[model samples]
Target chain A: MKLYEYLAKEEFRKFGIPVPPGRVAASPEDAAAAAREVGRPVAIKSQVLAGGRGKAGGIRFADTPEAAEAEARALLGTELHGHAIDRLLVEEKLRIDRELYLGVTVDGAARTPLVITSVRGGVNIEEVPEKELVKRHVDPTWGLQPYACRQVVRRLGLGGPVGRQVADILGRLYQVFRSRDAELAEINPLVVSGDRVIAADARLNVDDEAAYRHKDLPRVEEGTELERRVREIGLSYVELDGDIAVMANGAGITMATLDIIQAYGGRPANFLDAGGGASVEPMAQAVEVLVSTRPKAILINIFGGITRCDDVANALVQVRQRVGIPMPLVVRLVGTNEAQGVEILRREGITAYRSMDEAAARVVELAKGAA
Target chain B: MAILVDEKTRVVVQGITGHQGAFHARQMLDYGTRVVAGVTPGKGGEEVHGVPVYETVEEAVEKHGANASAIFVPAPFARDAAFEAIDAGLRVVVIITEHIPVHDAMQVMAFGRSRGATIVGPNTFGVISPGKSKLGIMPNPIYRPGPVGIVARSGTLSYEIAANLSGAGLGQSTVVGMGGDRVVGLGFVDVLKQLERDEETRAVVLVGEIGGTAEEEAAEFIKGMTKPVVAYLAGKSAPPGKRMGHAGAIIERGRGTFESKVKALTAGGARVAGFPWEVPDLVREALGQAAG
Candidate 1:
């Protein structure tokens, strides 16, 4: 789950990592009040969960409280690259002598925590030259040692008081990364103003699987209206900009169905997994959620192992009875109690296919016809 | 012989009293797996599906001679359960629990490697050696005793591909799900090394997705192996940075793209199939090339 910049800065503060004073403003008046409170030139940044915000003009600098309010008013209710700007972080802008990059992320290649440091900082870290970036893998058993922090600092060509200070911050950052179950904790543009260094930007991504451990964290930012609704019904859902909605029982099957649908020239509107051992209520709710998207067609692919196909068919029957089938649905059900499940669907005048390729092709044809 | 488990392999289940643990445990027993003991703290002496229950993995191993353990513990307690199995000197440990914290997963992996144990997954569907032994949650009817060795990062995709192979009169020697999490216990390369050494596995079928460099790493390793390998990669049309159901199934920073994975696997002398139905034909062609 991605935390808003203001929240990430607050979390960094709790770990003794220095961050400039900031406040989240929900309105233009709040932004003005915050700017006046800071009594300095402030940066007003849109609190969206996507990247490239600077390029999209979601970030603006204001020297006065009036200017801050004007910028906030201009950005508020505006869409910056599709994400609506509802919140902004107003913070004191620092006078940077130099900027450095520091990040800790889980490395899939090493299967361990990797700490990355570089002299290249600010926006577009991805565009930074690889030769400038220094990476070190922390031993999973021993964790980040004090010496390792100093080594990274040295490799980044730091020395004297600033080097020691940044090393201390790096150690604390590792602590927050591990203790908070963060998938990524990054501070791009670790600015040096006079003798003090502050994290100019905070980016944190906590693991969704470990979210239960962080009870104090606010509700995670949800994506799309359909995603939020399906989440409430306790099903995994992700909305995509396409023409067909794909549903399956397991994560693996859901993805394969999506691949097949796209391979057959059908664009998937969303990815939905009913999850293991789903009952009639959740199954019916899943269909209802998919139908709410108003896609051209819906593809239901079930290769039931622990999930009985008859139960899924029963849920489809319930949904058909209530909401009525507004869109073309191509269902492919197999495995446990499949014959009975097909019988149930057949009685309702719904023909279920046995081949995934056949079902995906049929859905593509239906989606094309609807288009 | 099978890659990991066979008829002689005795098994123990952790968290046997929980809902998922109990349900899958019964299924494993019905698949002809030698389930010798079950472990659920404070529920010792209770019998689950006619298997003796113990308080700890050590007791289960010492008393019943269980060489392998399948964990069904919840996410919060998954780390301890995995450590217990490793500390008890079990030869193989399969963690079927999903959503284990990354830090805990790293620790479990480090400890297991230090002890020279094979840890299957923290979110996997487990492993199966068709006809002889089944230690995972895969449907038995889909698999048959044959020469194909299957290793996948997906559970249901493996089942679908295996069933398709069986439908085409081909069978499997062993199938392993390496888990779909970012920080998993094993990878395609690890499973591939074992399959290369197994006499029963004449060829390998790798099921991969867009996320992670495991498939790329496996591609590099396949260059040195004598056996032929065929691959099928999912999420070809998935957008970048979107998590496709699985946490590890996202393409980040242009690293784990479908194009890159297919390119790497194809360069490694493996025939990459575009669809699940096409895997059997590729496998058959590769096997024929090996024979000729």
Candidate 2:
């Protein structure tokens, strides 16, 4: 889950990391109030869970309270990079002697937390040259030591009080990263004004799996209504822009089903994983959810491993009877009582295709015909 | 002859009394795997499918001489279960639990590395050498013993590919699910290296999805291997920034895109399949080229 910039800064403050004085505003009036509270010349940043916000006009400079309100009004209800912006982070603009980058993220290859610092900052780290960035892999067991932070700072050609402050911020940043169960904790443009260092921008992405432990973190509402509904029903779902709604048993096969559909000249409206070993009710609910999408057609591809094909077939039959599917339904079911599954579907006057390629082709034709 | 588990390997099922553990234990035993014991922490001195149940991995290892462990413990306690198995000196530990915290997974990976153990997954379908032994939850009927070795990030997709290969008269030597999480134990590179050395495997099929550099890392290794590698990637039509069910299957910062993985694998001399069904034909062509 990606935290809003204001929330990330709040976490930074909790960890003793310096952040510019800021207030979260949900409306234009609140933003104006926040600007006044922060004195004058504040930065109004949209609190949307997306990247490239600055380029997308999600961030704007406000020289007065009225300008802050106007900027907030322009951004508050607008969608930036497909995320709806309802809140703004109004903060006092910092005077930067230099901008530096500090980040802590997992190195997937090394399976360790990597602390990345650069002399060059205020820009995308991906665009930075390798030589300008100093990366240190901190062992999870020992964590980020003071010497390690100082060493990285020195390598970036910094020394004296500013160096020590940067090193101190790095240590605190590590604390926030680890304690918050963050997949990524980044402070771009770690502004150095005189001897003080402050985080000008903060980004924190908490691990979804570790969410149960961190109940204090606010939940960020994301995705479409159907996407949220399917998640509530314990299915992994992502909404896409297409005509055919697709559902499958696992993540891999669902994605493959989408690819196959597109390969056969069909467009998928959504990606839904019915999960492994889904029984009758959840499967029925999954179909109901897909039907709710009001797509031209619905295709459910199941290659059962732990998930029994018969259970999936039963759900299809059950949903067909109860909900009365308004669109063309194509199902390809195989593995683990597959014969029984196909037989069950056959009795319901529904033909279950054993081949994914053939089933995908049929669905594409059906969707195109419907169109 | 297989890369990971075979007929001689002794197995211990952790969380044996649980639903998934008990069900798959029976499945593994029915598949002719040497499932000697089970560990359920408090449910010791019991019998699950005629296999002795122990409180800890140490007892299972000591009493039954079990060298491998299949864990079906819940996510919260998955790390402790893995630590227990690793501490017991079990060289092959397969964690079937999903939703394990990334920190715990990292710790397990580090601990497993330190102990010289091969941890299969924190969330996986497990490993299988068809007709020899089964250590996972994959349906036994779909696979057949043959020359092709499969290493995949996705379980059901591998099954789909393997079933197609089997139908095309190209059976697998072994199929390893490297798990779907961002941080997993055995990666494409690790499993590919093993398959490259295995005598039974003539050609390897890499079933990869978007996200992570696992496929790219495997591509680097594929360049040096004499065995032909056929790669099939999913999530081709998937939008960027959306997690495609699998936690690891996402395109971040334009890295780990389907195009990039295909480019890297193709550059490394592997035949990249456009779809799952096309994999078998590519594998056949790869084998034919190797023979020619």
Model 1 chain B, poorest ten-residue lDDT window? B132-141
Q: Candidate 1 DockQ category?
A: medium
Best by lDDT: 2
> What is candidate 1's TM-score for chain A?
0.95
Strongest candidate by TM-score: 1
Candidate 2 TM-score over all chains jointly: 0.97
Going through the candidates in order, their DockQ values are: 0.72, 0.78
Worst 10 residues of 2 chain B by lDDT: B103-112
Docking band of candidate 2? medium
Q: Give the alpha carbon lDDT tens digit for every residue of B27-134 in model 2.
A: 999999999999998899999999999999999888889999999999988999999999999989999999999988988888898899999987799999999998
Candidate 1 C-alpha error for residue A124, in Å: 2.0
What stretches of model 1 exceed 4 Å from their correct place?
A: none
Model 2, stretches more than 4 Å misplaced?
A: A62-75
Task: Give a tens-digit lDDT track for model 1, residues A156-240.
Answer: 8999999999999999989889988999999988998899989998998998888999989986666877788887898888888
Q: Candidate 1 residues B73-138, lDDT tens each? A: 999999999999999999999999988998899889889889999999878889999988877777
